[model samples]
Target: MIINKILNVDDYYYDVFMAISGTLTGFSANELQSTGLAETYYKHILGQIETATFLEFLNVSKSILENSFSQDQLRNAIQSEIMADPGMQDMSNNIITMWYLGTWEGTYVNELSYKESLVWNVMHAHPPGAKQPGFKSWAVQPVNSNS
Candidate 1:
């Protein structure tokens, strides 16, 4: 007889969230953790959505991450499994927006998240007025300014 394994989302909900966020945002888990806002984002998401629905989303995300082997496969799995569901779409979009823009539901999550937002890095700039680059550092060119 074969025993089916149960998906224990509560055992690894945050891990699943990070993996899903990385996949959704095209960033790695390490990058997301480096922001120091993973816990904040996780709690925010939990507070925004219902417990049962959040657990279900975590379970689906866990399955997709497990079954996907390559980036292409991951994208396909996400498109079919997560993006296909209206509820999951909202959660996924929020996760992507939070990672890239440091906001959720069109509002800034916090000052920390805004400071460490990924969109600035993607655009090869820092968040305006967040990180001062020293006195007159703009005289020369930025170190990573070259495309």
Candidate 2:
């Protein structure tokens, strides 16, 4: 239920999370809940918006979702809003980073497996310590994933 509240979806919190995350962080939330990462993310978000209330963030998320803004629009608006509300912006980016990195920056109670991380897709590279293609792989070339 809290997941739905976060994404402002009526049902299928995973799908809603997938959409919001894909839109917000450019990562998929598929299987994230099964790994318990979704719950951890929800807690992190709830903590970030605890100042006024979870409902405050929910109201904002609901408003944003109702508009069906494009990902760029959502990102730009959030980027601008960070000036006015830095904490929420940091929290939002942290959420995105969680989707991206599969880990939070600071200490947290929940455990995460870096092996399950998603940033590899964004970066178009191999995970650290996972493998080495060969000597000088980095020197030769790497695809420009962002482009």
What's the count of clashing pairs in each model shown? 0, 0
For 2-109, candidate 1 gives per-residue lDDT tens digits of 112222335467777777777788887778888989888988988987988988988888887777777788789888988899988988888899999999898889
lDDT of each: 0.80, 0.54
What is the C-alpha lDDT profile of model 2 across 1-147, one tens digit per residue?
A: 123433444444334444455556644455454444666666565565554554454455545555545767666655554325766566566656777676566544344545445666556676678645678786765685453
lDDT of 2: 0.54
Candidate closest to the true structure, highest TM-score: 1
Each candidate structure's TM-score, on Cα atoms with residue i matched to residue i, is 0.84, 0.55
Local distance difference test, candidate 1 = 0.80
